[model samples]
Target chain A: MNAISSFTASLPGACAQGLIWGIMALGVFLTFRVLNTSDLTVDGSIATGGAACIMLIRSGVPAWTAALAAACCGMLAGLVTGLLHTRCRIPAILSGILTQLALYSVNLRIMGSKANQPVSVDKYSLMLSQRYVRAAGLSNPIPLLVMIISALIGLAYYFFGTEIGCAVRATGNNRVMARAQGIDTDRATILGLIVANGLVAFSGALLSQYQGFADVNMGRGAIVIGLAAVIIGEVVFGKLLALNFALRMSSVVFGAIVYYIVLQLVLALGLNTNDLKLISAVIVAAFLTLPNMKGGDRDA
Target chain B: MLEMIDVCKTFNPGTVNEKVALDRLSLRLEEGDFVTVIGGNGAGKSTCLNAVAGSFAVDSGKILLGGVDITHMPAHVRAKYLGRVFQDPMMGTAPDMWIEENLALAARRGKKRGLKWSISERERAEYRELLAPLGLGLENRLQTKVGLLSGGQRQALTLVMATLKKPQLLLLDEHTAALDPKTAAVVLELSDRVVQEHSLTTMMVTHNMRDALAHGNRLIMMDEGRVKLDVRGEEKKKLTVRDLLEVFEI
Candidate 1:
């Protein structure tokens, strides 16, 4: 197969990963974009989800169910940040850091005496009963993409349309307006964190299942990756927060696809593995400055 | 039907920046009473509305709506009885959602929200009916994102959304103060139509002395956190912008 066809064939995988990581993008989106609060909780919540899913899946729960439970675990992790921020009057960013630090140990305990689990090597053997893979045919990426994308779009569209969604959006855009409209800003912040982290952990659950294990180190650079995808998504649409639901979701999904394609290109070109971090950093810097890269003057 | 008894508020309490926003500030509103308030910066106009809406717990006060003591209720709990439009158009609704979605959220005020579908055909029809009243051609734009609307359109929509649930009190905190003169006039007309149609008790704060006298049934002027002028009935109808300025010596 030519490089082009090969590249086209792998596009769906990247979209699916983008779609999954969009959950992380969403958590990042809420704290950063929507609530206008800087929350670093996602760095730890991603690992929390992976650890919970790995531990649960090891004890004989279905992978799908394990993923859902992991999402809940991630939500509780966010709840900690919310409580700290609201009850203690701490700044939102600092509260996030406190929770992120505490969850480091909490996540360690969820992994069953291990710091992390590797799924590519550890999960292939135990993913599902033999009958399931045979039934699913293990040959098509379309089904997985179909399921994940549907969940992301449908749930996202619905959640942001509700009364609570309005409250959350209002809180982020202007706390004073929310208060005038009778919305409890504290409650809105807490709700945003719960939903954001829940989606992040959902991505983690899928990440472990698809790649075949969870690792403690997996979440170390997650905030940067998630922010990159979100920023890339925003760049595609010009980062207008008030864009309609479709554009809002597209920012994150498109971002993830572009991020993956870049990595795939690097892998295909035989780039040194040790240079991955440097490559990621450069790409992030470039994307960060992409709007500025346009010939338009910054002041203009 | 709203009452504030000796409402008192202090900001940055117990610190060097301690400032009294409201001090022994008492106010009352009978059913369908519309009052306009004007004050200089830091004159406590916004703080009064905040205290009544439960945005902050007043240090010492009792707030009652239709004779129910709601002084201690959280903001959301009191929201059912209060409809509000803010100075900024973007402050009122979720801009990312569709116009109808914003309307749906407002239309169901005081009801429990569930995981069920939010915008059904019936809900859309209801939203269309609500938008039809505005006559800004917004009923046709239910699918549009509210963020794409003009400032006047947003404030008009906000007025419609505020009254959709028929709250006991409608509060406008310089809602049109942020708009241009022409757009502000359109929004003010919409506000007048909706408030009169619902017979809603209302309080509006505006810097423009003319707007303070034009639409509402009564008018109030605040100076240094106190009511400097209050007029209603024939006295209010006979008053002009000059009368208001002379009364407050502005």
Candidate 2:
């Protein structure tokens, strides 16, 4: 009875976290699956988002406005990485790494060199918070998070159907073909990076608000978690759902939800919280390798 | 419609692998000219085509297209006036996209891409009519991914895409070399029909000596980055395989 109640009590919190992290996972899906680039900038940019949002809110800015600023901060980080890759001729992975390394200091500066900053819910009207996870009233965080995720998905689905969006997809699908068609692949790449990092930062901003504080190390191993969500969503829901872009994206969110609920269960079962990163790494590696180990290596 | 003057290209300068790919080469094409290019390996045949297509900056030269000096234009920007089909079937189309989506992409080549929906009802109807002549049944498979298409089918689709926008110049870099003999013949035929119907200025590179002679009004043989033989009109009509072999032996 005790174990069951504890699990039930923790389920809502885990769901909230999953939904929030699902936004970051959507960003990962954009760069990883859509743009076909393994961007590592999210790790540092998420922290930048958190730092920017909390700092802005602490300075008396509105929460929503602060979230937008955080997303812009993330977009700038992606732009730096994009320019480094395109204009400076650096490889994609290395450019992301360099930008992530540089963002460490930038995030620190944003937080006034402090390792952490707290946004008091009593003093500020945050959009979503842990306090509202089980609240009986309209302040429940799940509905709002779901609404936000749906809105983002709708926007993405619409955008990707547009001319510029098709060009971006073509750029990722085949650079040579894109160039042949007069699509500026460099511009497409930069735009994809900007949009991806913007989502990641936006998630970070929401996460900081949810947790009531932003820590410098909060975004550590974030890419792994995001990937785990993506892979988990794809592997689990892919067979059950119709193969549409929007459904695939929504699966990524569900993947995050499932991931957190499982994490909560593991912790309840006596797994050390500190070893969660190792477990995440192992999970991602296994999931990443499973498809390749099967029959995907054979070419037609 | 196309001119290459004093074009020069050297690969890996200052290295042991340094090779002069194009050495002060020059060529001129009249409007509506369809020229077939032939060469042995290392003859800079593809390099010459790539230079005109702006794949890379020429070491030194001027390339004029339809009275526009495009010597320094970036490859994508230059694509506004040019259509290109590569030897590799995979190089010409986005594999993950649908057939109609790929056509839609090519339809907007060199044109501004905005927030408008990529494919419309009118464009879909146009694509169906355009693809109906190809006889590949692609009109009904508009939503089919290009990756699922055969190499020959892909090349045919690429041909349609290249000419969809009526480019100022069309470049075929051994476009049919990778296809089977039958498929190559069909693509080559389609190439001729499209080029003639559109009155397009075209440059086709071929490894098959007979194909070089068989198609196009003018034929040029490239050797050591220079034009060893250029024949057209009566001189080109009377030429045979023996004469091309003699030139190759030299």
Candidate 3:
């Protein structure tokens, strides 16, 4: 009974964290599913966003402006990765890895050579914070996060229906067809990576504000977590929400929440927190193999 | 309407697998001319067509399309004036997109793509009219994904896409090679109708000698990266598969 109450108390906070990470998952979906490239830059860019945001806030920038600026920084990171992949002729995954490795030093520099920085809500007037997570009315983070996600989804749906967005989609689907149709495929690819990393950094900015601190290692293994959210969302809500683009994106958010809920449950069951990364790896691997196992059954 | 002046291209120069794909090959197409290209394996038939389509740069040559020098233009920039259909049906269309969506993409081939909605109601009606004549029932299946269609249907859709906006030149590189004979004949007939309807300057490459003789007004046979025979008008009308075989020394 005691453990159950403790788990219930933690549920709201878990949900809030899930929503923040959902934005990052949406970014992952853009590269992994839509653009058909597995970009590892998010692992570094997320931290860059956090570092940039917290430092800006510390230096007296407005919270919203700092977040936007952080997102732009992430776009720059993505541009580097795009140039490496398209212009330098490096492979996509390798390009991401190189950018991610380089961003470690860049991230540290952004944080004024510190590995960690904290922005107390009391001092900085943050947009959202964990302190008011379970509070009622306007103070609750859930409603605000929902509103932000809805706006993002609406923008994405509208943009994708437009001519430029369709060109980007075609670039991902078939390069030969895209070129034949007169699309600058390399330009389209660069634009996609730029937008994807921007979203990832924006999410990181929000997460830093919520947790009241930014750590250099906060974004470690971020790609796996983002992939977990996307795959879990598809596996659980894919058929039910396969109606439109908005619903599909919402499913990714819900998937992130479910992942956090599961994580909280296991933690409450007395599992050592040190093994959290191991558990995450196991969960992702199991989910990744599920579809292949079904296909193997047919072959057998 | 199109000119290739002494274009030369070599694949993997100085390597063991080096090949001279085009060796000072030159060809010109008059407006409204429909030419069929025939050649054997390694005869540079497709390579010549690709060179015109800007698939690769010629090592040393000039390509002029409609009086503009486009020898250095990239493939996508060159695509503003040229339409292409490939040997593989899968190469010409986006499989995962809707049929109407695919047509909408082709409709904006040479135009600037902006923030405007991709498929307007007017364009939808236009695409429907275009698909109706194919007799493939694709007009009713506008929302269906192209991947679900058969190979023959895709090739037909690709043909319509290539001609959606009248191109300065059309390049068909053995587009029907992978289809069954009956489907190939249907697509070929459709191709003839569309080309005639638009009076398009078209170059069709095929391995089948009979198809080469039957479709277009002019025929050219390529051997070792150069045109060996250029027959047209009265001479092309009297030529047969026997005459072509004699030229091949088979």
Candidate 4:
């Protein structure tokens, strides 16, 4: 009964975390799989979203409203990085570093008094099902219920089908060709960053509210988690190379679910919380090597 | 309606390995010009196209297209006025994208307000009509991934894509050079059909002297990054392989 109860307790938050991280997982999919470049702004921007949302909600903004604001802020951060890379001609990895560095100060400002927000849940985050429960005057597991109801999946489907989304996906595959076809690779990069970081920020917004507090370190190790979920998704569900946009998206979502399950196992194995980053690093490192190993060698 | 004024480009400008890809090269293309360019390897034929395509910012020069100064433009900005097909068939179209999706992207040239993306009924009708001219039965494969197409088919499709918007200039960077001989001939014929049908001002660069002579209303021979011999009108219409060889001193 204790084991079953403990597992149940962890379910909502873990699942919510997976859904939230699913946003970043899809974002990382753009840089890693789609854009065919690496952008690390996700690490800081995820936190940037949390900090921005926490501060906003504390100022009396609605929960999902704060989340939307955070997503916008995340998009701006990503825009800076995309501009640095595309306009300034800086390499993609270096551009991400520059944006990540600049965001550090911005995130601190968002935390306001140097401490993260601890706004009353008032019924969990606005996105959590508790808000719906409050409206309905009934008992409900807000997180699980809200996850199914949110625009997360539907919005993803819609965005990936747009003309701009087609152009963005093509940019990941080959920027030069996309541009030659007048797809405007620079614009695509900027938009991809905006969408990517927006998703991450949305995740952060939901995460902060669900946990009942927003911490400065909540975004730590987020990239590892996103990548693990993405790679695990590619592994277990097979690759999405030939699949349509919707299937590819659902694949990444599944990847995020499996990744958290694996993460939970690590906790069950008696690993310390501090060692989690190390474990994540090891997992990412292992997955990164899989592509190289499978392909034999393909340079240029 | 295209011109290059004293265009110059030097890679590794200050280094010993520096190469003057274009040196004071000048050329003019009248409206409806279909200039066939031919030269040996490292003769700066591709560089000339690159300069016009905005693939590289020339060290010193002015490229004007349709009376607009585009020399300062980068590749993507100049793409509006220019349609390009690369030597690598894979470089011309997005492989993972469907045929219609790729066509939709091409169709976006010179237009705006792209509301997210909804391929309207009119757009679908337009795409089908556009593919019908290719005659490869590709109109039936609108949803098929471009990656699965043959090199010849892709190249033929690229020809359709480059001319889709009827840009100010079309750059065929040895587009069919990557295909096998039979496939190359088929693509070349398709290129002729599309260019003629659209009446597009086109530039085709090739190493085949026969192809150069066999196609286009105008012919240019480049040497050491400069247009050494340009023949057009009646003279170009009467060009022979031997005459081109004499011009190249081959």
The prediction achieving the highest lDDT against the true structure is: 2
For all predicted structures, in order, the TM-scores are: 0.85, 0.98, 0.97, 0.90
Please report how far candidate 2 places residue B121 from its true position, in Å: 0.5
What C-alpha root-mean-square deviation, in Å, does candidate 1 show against the real structure? 4.3
Query: Which is the better candidate, 2 or 4, if ranked by TM-score?
Result: 2
Docking tier of model 2: it is: high
Q: Report the lDDT tens digits of candidate 1 across residue range A202-249.
A: 777777766667777667777777778878887876555666665777
> lDDT at A269 for candidate 2?
78
Order the candidate numbers by lDDT, best to worst: 2, 3, 4, 1
For model 4, give the interface RMSD. Answer: 1.8
lDDT by residue (A105-171, candidate 4, tens digit) is 7787788858577766563345553223224333343445345424566676776677777778778
Q: What is the interface RMSD of candidate 3, in Å?
A: 0.6
lDDT for model 3 comes to 0.92
- How big is the positional error of residue B180 in model 1, measured in Å on the Cα after superposition? 2.6
Which residue ranges in model 4 land beyond 4 Å of their true spot?
A: A1-9, A113-116, A122-150, A239-242, A286-300, B116-118, B133-135
- Note the B-chain TM-score for every model: 0.95, 0.99, 0.98, 0.95
Model 4 DockQ (Cα-based): 0.61
lDDT per prediction?
A: 0.79, 0.94, 0.92, 0.79
Model 2 CA deviation exceeding 4 Å by range: A1-4, A298-300
> Which candidate tops TM-score?
2
